[model samples]
Target chain A: MKAIVHVGLKPGVLDPQGKAVADTLGRLGFDEVGSARIGKVIELDLTGDLDAAAAEARVREMCETLLANTVIESYRIELQA
Target chain B: MKAIVHVGLKPGVLDPQGKAVADTLGRLGFDEVGSARIGKVIELDLTGDLDAAAAEARVREMCETLLANTVIESYRIELQA
Candidate 1:
């Protein structure tokens, strides 16, 4: 199985990196861009021993415990086999 | 239409953020963690004007021009309505 974890700063939070990217885009001629919020993608290839839900739960725990700062960021997990 | 752009550091490139996260995870008891590679995800809700491929192309251009550095990162685009 393979899983992808997408983590990002929640709306209304300050994101300096995202702001910098948006600024760079404006300079590059994409003036219509309103905003940019940057985040992280963590992809993992796992063995097939665990059921999808179990694996997802494990991943969720990983995110809550270590992968993301739940106070300022949120994460979504996608499972692929 | 809605689109998602996932950008990440390419393998073999140095990923200090990923390393830092992995180190943090290990300290937090996820010793099974092998490696961590950090990236970014951009989700956009768009109007219904452009076709999926066209929007994807625009996003790819954006990634190349602003969202990602071709030297160290690669991107994937997903479209939804």
Candidate 2:
């Protein structure tokens, strides 16, 4: 199975990277562009016999414990075969 | 409309960040983790009357031109409303 994790600054939080992308887009004549927010995606190729729910729980724990800063960020997880 | 862009190192590319995450997970006892690849996801709450297909085309162009390094990275785009 494969798991994809996405982490990003929470709504209402300041995102310098996203701002930079937006700024660059504006300068490049993409006048229609209003905002851009950047986040991280981690694709994991799992092994062994970990079941789906267990894998999700473990992955969520990983996110809350290490992969993301919950204070100022939010994360989403997706699983695929 | 909203646009979500997922950018990641190509299959053959080296990802130091992903490796770091994997190392940390291993140390934390996620022995089931075999490999981790890190990437980026950008979510934009777009404005204007940009049609879905047109927005996607523009986004693809943006990815090709600046948002991603095609030589070493791959990108996927999604549209949500």
Candidate 3:
């Protein structure tokens, strides 16, 4: 099975990297762009007989413990068999 | 409009960060994990009257020119109104 996680800053959190990108885009002639935010995607390959529910639960644990800060960031997970 | 871009290393590319994550997960007792890969998600807010197709095309250009390093990374773009 495969687990895909998308972790991003929570709303109202400041994102300097994203701000830089947006500013650069404006200078580069992409005037349509108003803002930008950057985040992380982690893909994990698992080898086990666990069912979908168990896998998702385990992955969520991983997020809370190691993968995400949880205070200023939020994460979403997707699983594939 | 909003554009979401997911950028990831190509299949054959080596990802040191992902390897470190996998190793750490193993040490942290996630023995089921076989491997991991890390990627980026960039969200952009756009202000324009352009249609969906046009917005997508413009964002693709942004990816090609600045957002993604096409030599080693591949990117997918999603648009939302």
Candidate 4:
């Protein structure tokens, strides 16, 4: 089985990296660009011993404990077998 | 409009970051974890001037030229209104 965790900053948080990227895009002539917010994608491959529910639960726990800083970021989980 | 670009390492490419993360997870007691690949998610907000197709093309170009290292990475683009 495989799981993908997509992590993003909360809406109100300031993202300097995104701001830099947006500014660079404008300098590069993409004038229509308004803003950019950078995040992370964590892909995990696991043994098939666990069922879908268990896999999702474990992955979610991983996100909560290690993959994300819940105070300023949010994450979504997608599981594939 | 909004666009999300997900950049990931190509298959067979070495990912030291992923290896480190997987090892950390194992140390933290998530022993069932097999492999972990870390990637980036870039979210762009643009003016509604461009149509969906055009927006996608522009974002794809951005990924190819700036956001991702196409030599060893692959990117996927998603456009949302």
Candidate 5:
């Protein structure tokens, strides 16, 4: 099974890296771009004989414990068989 | 419109960051975890009057030119209206 986690900053948080990308895009002539926000996607491969529900729960715990800094960031997890 | 880009290392590329995550997970007792790979998710807000097709094409160009390191990374773009 696999767990795909998307971790992103909260809406009100400042994202310097994203701003830099947007600025670079503007300089590159991608004038249509207004803003860019960068985040992380962590993919985990699981080997145990866990069911979908169990995997989702385990992955959620992983996200809370290490994958995401919940104070300023939010994460969404998707599980696949 | 918005474009969500997922950038990840191509298979066989050495990902030390990912290795570190896996090692940490094991230390934290997430024994089911076999491997962990980290990537980037970049969300871009588009302001111009571009149709769906045009937006996708434009985003693809951005990926090829700047957003992705084509030599060792792959990117997938998703556009949302």
Candidate 6:
């Protein structure tokens, strides 16, 4: 099974990197670009015998514990066989 | 309008950050984790008046020209109103 996690800054969080990119885009003539927020995608390939629900639970735990900074970030999970 | 871009390493590309994360997860007891590939998601908020198709095309161009490294990275664009 595979699990894909999208981790992003929480609303109202300051994103320096996003701001930098946005400014760059504006300078590069993409004036239509108002804001650019950057995030992370972690694609995990799982092995061993774990059911879908079990894997999801474990992955969510992992996200909470390490993969995402819960205080400042939010994550979405998608699973595939 | 908003455009979400998912940028990822093309298959066969080496990802040291992903490898490190995978190793760390294994040490932290996620034995089921076989591989972890890390990527980037860029969320762009568009302010100017661009129709859906035009915005997508412009975003795609931005991806190819600046957002993604065409040699090793592939990007997917999703537009939202």
The DockQ of each candidate is 0.42, 0.80, 0.90, 0.82, 0.90, 0.88
CA error at residue A27 for candidate 3, angstroms: 0.8
iRMS of candidate 2, Å: 1.2
TM-score of every candidate relative to the true structure? 0.77, 0.93, 0.98, 0.95, 0.97, 0.97
- For model 2, residues A1-81, the per-residue Cα lDDT tens digits are 888988888889999988999888779877667899998888877888878999899899988989999999998999887
Whole-model lDDT values for every prediction: 0.77, 0.88, 0.96, 0.92, 0.95, 0.95
lDDT of 3 by residue, A1-81 (tens): 999999999999999999999999999999999999999999999898999999999999999999999999999999998
Specify the poorest-scoring 10-residue window by lDDT in model 4 chain B. Answer: B57-66
Model 6 whole-model lDDT (C-alpha atoms):
0.95
After the best TM-score superposition of candidate 5, give how far the Cα of residue B45 lies from its true spot, in angstroms: 0.4
TM-score of 1: 0.77
TM-score of chain A of each: 0.91, 0.93, 0.97, 0.96, 0.96, 0.96
In model 4, the clashing pairs are: none
Off by over 4 Å in 5: none
A24-71, model 4: which lDDT tens digit per residue? 998998887899999999999887599989999999999998999999
Which regions of candidate 4 are displaced past 4 Å? none
Tens digits of per-residue lDDT, candidate 6, B19-60, equal 998999999999999999999999999998899999999999
lDDT of 5 by residue, A1-81 (tens): 999999999999999999999999999999999999999999999997999999999999998999999999999999888
Model 5 chain A worst lDDT window (10 residues): A55-64
Write candidate 4's Cα lDDT for B1-81 as tens digits: 999888999999999999998999999999889999999999899985899999999998788778999999999999899
Model 2: runs farther than 4 Å from truth? none
Number of backbone clashes in candidate 6:
0
Stronger candidate by TM-score (3 vs 6) = 3
Error of 6 at B2 (Å): 0.6
